[model samples]
Target: MKNTILILFITLLSVSCKKEPQYLVKIEGKQLPISAEIASDKTIEDFILPYKEKVEAEMNTVLSYTPKDLVRIDGKLESSLGNLMADLCFERANPVFNSRTGKNIDFAMLNFGGIRAGITKGDIKTINAFNLMPFENSLVVVEMTAEKVTELAKYLIAQNKAHPISKQLNLIVEANEYNLTIHNLPLDDSKTYFVLTSDYLQNGGDNMVFFKDPVKLFKLDYKVRNSIIDYFTEIDTIKVELDGRFTKEN
Candidate 1:
């Protein structure tokens, strides 16, 4: 009996000291479909219903109207959508920048790819602004010398894409040479120009390295999306046209 008890105790101790087996599960099976019959939790649905309803209401609120469709397309010097967005950026941020720095924003530039969606010929809603500028990029003023501005123009010419540029600047691209005018005047290499752009571009987004080394940077603390929304709210109708702000010649 003593031997039996000792043996049992030793066995139990050895079993307890044994290491647990490791598992290397190789799941090799096709994905199974989730059936629609699965019932949702009523508690979760109740909790989310109010927030969903509020969001839908706000998103569906009409802000403005567009008579024509504005779209961003490739291989074009300019687009209606690009013109509208850049103009709005300038219109909205210029006053704030002037108020803070007492300097006028010479022009505004936005990446073509940044304007995510097109505006249809119908009512523009708050959700449209959200969809157009989905990123949280803030407007910032970059103080650049005329030389830097020249570099920017050259960059635009080389890119040959539909980059959004305000009316204050014009570019004519020829075979090997490019002509750039700011405010209907030739670029003065001695002057410094304040330019409004998103923080993303100022930080070298979209290969806009010229915006990197600025003489000064002013953070407007204004989101680009909010600017669009505000502009839409202030205007009853939105109008934009392609007036050869950017042109190409052989």
Candidate 2:
């Protein structure tokens, strides 16, 4: 009887002392967790999660490939000149022509070493693009002129095959020597030219000395990688296409 009374007393005391939740619960606005997505019937994980998983899967898949496939991947880069074009054209040479100036621009110049991987004879994946650029670069269009362009070409011609990364323009060679029109064309020193490129090239880190801006017109808020991703995504179902803009000539 005494034990029962003691237990009952303790239970009643515990119940009486129990505190309410300490949270100052406020009914703030709520959202349904909508997210930016690929917009498809296919299932997709979240940005960080799915991105992580797909990368892991590709990593594993690439690792298991045969030596023959590996050779093709490396061969595609070695045997072709796209590496040179992509390297020089895309790096610091993104051009946006202004209608006000009537200044026509050519293909964005980037160099080969900047292109770090091959397309592997299959659909290019997100990881493939990442491996290509791999740097924290953004597209910057700088206002330049025909004279500055001419000067830029002269500098490019002097580099020869010893150089790799592109600073302003893609150079195609005829027998390990470049004999091209874009590089030799006359440039007007008086006309303002807008060149699109990454900040890295603008800062002159890519050995592109022409990035010296008398004036900078616009800067992109997007990363170069994201821009590449968006660009590849919209290429009409062809995830990766090599036009061979950089061709071999005898």
Candidate 3:
């Protein structure tokens, strides 16, 4: 009987000691605005000065030169910057892909918004590559079916934006129908086409669903920004133009 009473007492004690859940009765938010009125901390600035200087020096290093400004808004259905981005990525990524799998990428595609900034008509610096593609998107090649390729063309025509496409592709949108040629040949339904693009697009980013669920995926493990940097380093001048890669008929 004594042991039973002790057990009951312990159980009661445990129940009584249990903490109740805390509830939030109200929520208050405060606005903190950053302005020049706030004084800089000298100690903090001194500590960061070396790193800042190093980064600035590295970013300011010249890579290549551009005779004219490369802007994404320069053309309809395609842009000079878009052309450069797609072509350079292909040029850089194809060799790597071919070396590994012995297969050549049929074409390259990238979203318009991927080009973050324009290259001014002057010396191209390392910072220009960073400014152009700030994301850590990697290069990936997807083998897509003819149906998926058609969907891709439809999406491009519907959006009617300057999505970056390599010179290998010739997309002509005419009313309800469109004509697409890869490497100057029409898309074959019996065979899959390999397309070079960033991992972001391969995962259906920016509503590019056609890129998702491809027949085969080849990851190059190369970053798009690095490709741009490498391309700039190798080339003395950057010249890109819209050579009727994509067109629309009225």
Candidate 4:
């Protein structure tokens, strides 16, 4: 009887000491305004100065020169800046895609709004590439069917914006109909075509739904801004032209 009482007391004591689960009941937030009133940390600032100077020097390094301004708003159906962006991306990304897949990208496309800045007639610096493409969008190749290609053409026609397309494609809009040729050849419905685009567009960004759910997807692991920088580094002078790659009948 004594031992039973002792065992019962120990059980009760153990139960009483058990911890209950705690939960977050409420969350309060306070805004700390960053203003001149707040003191700067001199140690941190001093440590970062060298890195900042190095980065600025690299960004200002001259890559190439442009004789004329490359602006996105310069053309109605196609812009000089857009032409250069698309052409350089195609040129840089094609070899990478070809080496992996043994096939070439039919063309490259980018949104008109993607060109964030313009290049003035002067020495081009590394910062120009970053200013032109401010996003971290990477290159991707989507193998699309003829039906999707038609949808792409229709989307461009309806928008009537100067969305960038590589020189490999010629898109002409007449009335409600459009004509498209890839690499100087008519688009063949019997075969699938590979198109180079940013990963963002391939995921249906900027209302470009035709690039989503492609027949096949190939990621080149290359960023668009990097491609622009590389192309600029290779060439001493940059040239751009609309060249009738895309046109609309009046």
Q: Per-residue lDDT of 1-250 in model 2, one digit per residue for the tens? A: 9999999999999999999688776879876765676354443444467788766885443221112111113232122324333343453234323433445444354444555665454465667567767887776666666666666555655543323323223445565455434434434456665555567776776688687763655665556666656555544333223333333455
Query: Highest lDDT: which candidate?
Result: 3
Off-target runs (Cα >4 Å) in candidate 2 are 1-106, 162-186, 236-250
| Prediction 4 TM-score vs. true | 0.89
Off by over 4 Å in 1: 1-35
Task: Give me the overall lDDT of model 1.
Answer: 0.92
- TM per candidate comes to 0.86, 0.51, 0.86, 0.89
Best by TM-score: 4
Report each candidate's C-alpha RMSD, comma-separated, in the order given: 3.7, 13.6, 3.9, 2.6
lDDT of 3 by residue, 1-250 (tens): 9999999999999999999999999999999899999999999999999999999999999999999999999899999999999999999999999999999999999999899999999999999999999999999999999999989988998899999999999999888788999998998989899999999989989999999988999999999999999999999998887899999988
Backbone clash total for model 1 is 0
Provide the clashing-pair count of each candidate structure: 0, 22, 0, 0
lDDT values for all models: 0.92, 0.51, 0.95, 0.94
Q: Which of the two candidates, 2 or 3, achieves a greater lDDT against the reference? A: 3
Ranking by lDDT: 3, 4, 1, 2
